[model samples]
Target: MNRPRLAVGATLACAGLLAVGCSSPSQQAAPAEQAATVNVALSDAGCSPTPATVPSGPVTFAVTNSGSAAVTEAELQAAGKILGEKENITQGLNGTFALRLEPGTYSVYCPGGQKDTWTFTVTGTGPAAPTAAPDTNVADATTKYHDYVVSEVNLLQPATKTFTDAVRAGDMAKAEAAFGAAREHYESIEPVAESFGDLDPDIDARADDVDDPAKWTGFHRIEKALWQDRSLAGMAPIADKLDADIATLKANVATATYQPAQLANGASDLLTEVSTSKVTGEEDRYSHTDLWDFAANIAGARTAFELLMPALQAKDADLAQQTEARFVDVTQQLARFKQGDGYVDYSTVGDADRRTLANSVNALAEPLSQVAGKVV
Candidate 1:
């Protein structure tokens, strides 16, 4: 069942504009003030220089990945949202990013399975700058993302009907084929699906989420019956439940609220899902249709990024261009694995190709994380 866990902690850290220390050549010279710099080292154990305290002003983070073979990402977060991040910090590389901070508590997330938490405090007496006025750009992006969710959910309705009908007819071969088609539409709108109370778990819950085996219902449960058990005797009810839940999602998404930051966070979360479970074939263990889900997740995330592009470009053109380029690269890489209108089975995808796909996803996730900061 491709139940996606939002990778909210992992954030983007990258090169951005340096703070101006002096006036331009055509203007009078001003006093030079060096921005504060923090050195952060990430390893398998934990981040070094833990619990750092800094002044409230422009600060630069010099991050080094001293971890093992597993790639790591570093991020600065506040109020459950990423403020800044640097991603794809390979075993031995270093990266840097600059951000202006206000007085507050923040955490540095080093996502590579490291459990140790690193937090910091920003303190200063300097008068805070006036907050920027709310812009319509973010509102527009949110509306677009909401519309996308509704469209995907609507697509799911007809697809689910076909899938359920195949199951009811006891045509196992046709049902199995219809399963992937129906799942693609669901996966594309998973974030929105999850917003509906209990609907997501009802339609896509894995066995782990259920306390009792008999209580488990929805796609994976039906999948087990169709593939592992090789029986359709008890699957019609599960199909009906899935159909109802999807209908519920269709109605909920019509009034769902979206934030500009969610688009960026959701994009990163999708890639994290691909790297964590989808690439490993753990998501669709029974049917081996992980590729379909993986592609749909990527499509969903890419759509969010595309909708936020205008606002992101206005704030940071360089970052926006970098993100778009990486998205194209990843999309092209995935296209290589396509077979006709669908993709090859996850079981048949080679290890090298999987690694390539993972790398491309990580590359895209890096810049995508910055979109929130730029747009919001």
Candidate 2:
């Protein structure tokens, strides 16, 4: 019998190989029969066993990237929804993922600009085996959250570059305008930003974070230079540091792992930032761009909530619906303050409007806090 090479530390070997052909008699009787397995080879052309139709039941895909590309990922998708996937499958190496798929049509995606897709079918099954156990749900949510972080971080790099370029060029007017846009991208994924030690502070530290006035740096430090001093003469190095910090964050987010509870708490923490600092007009004190950061923080927190929404809905639909409704309410209230792509200056808002915005955010935060308990 032929045996496909197994990935490192693979728990289960390729299924359906006859014990008589490949294993000794003693080895054959040692372990119970395992689920069926399929060997999938990914290369420049695409996935082999193209249209890998298989039976519906417990199945393991033994995937190998035989292509020249440095990295690739294999995903099992059905109806445009990902059922299972493994990322960072390096060339010439193998990786495996198991799934108990229901009878249906599925596609294998080997994404690397190859545009490779292998459509297959899962036949014969009473019902698709439910893979939505607590642990699985948490794992799926974590993967999605990491993906979101990567996307936001990718966007941050260019946006920060634009802001920093303007600052370094001594274009204070353009730099001030670019500030809110760059900050928004960072604010949206601030939770993941906390992972890289000192990077977040290096990019966003406020004046009080440093004891020495000369030591203060990052966005707030630059903010003072633009608004208070009304100049960008000494901001070139600061802008360069901010750009470097964002580059560091982008690298770190690619491998970061998140726990479901942390995601739940992260959403709440973003709101806490809004209520304590953003709402009070403290975060963008000089630029008066607090509203931009406030909205960005909402976008980020909402992303965390949306990522876990599937698990939450499965665990408790009523609570999920309630939480979703609250989010919509807050969004609508925030929209009232929108002016073009940004919001009205923080100082322009009257006390009544501030109180109303505070109440809306608080209301959403209350139900949002229960997400971890419901999902986990």
Candidate number with greatest lDDT: 1
**lDDT (Cα, tens digit) per residue for candidate 1, span 1-376:** 1232223332212211111111111221111324567887877866654339887655667778875544366666554444455555678877665555545566776654455457767776542433444455655776788788878888989998999999888999999989999989988766555534356668888777566788788888888888789999978888888888777777766765554655676676677667766888877889988898899989998898888787777678899899999989988988887988788888898899889988988788778765654543
Worst 10 residues of 1 by lDDT: 15-24
- Per-residue lDDT tens digits of candidate 2, residues 42-91? 77766655337766554666778776483365656543433344444568
* lDDT at residue 160 of model 1 (Cα atoms): 88
Q: Which residue pairs show backbone clashes in model 2?
A: none
Local distance difference test values of all predictions, in order:
0.68, 0.68
Clash count per candidate: 4, 0
Regions of model 2 farther than 4 Å from truth? 1-136
After superposition, which runs of candidate 1 have C-alpha atoms over 4 Å from their true positions? Answer: 1-134
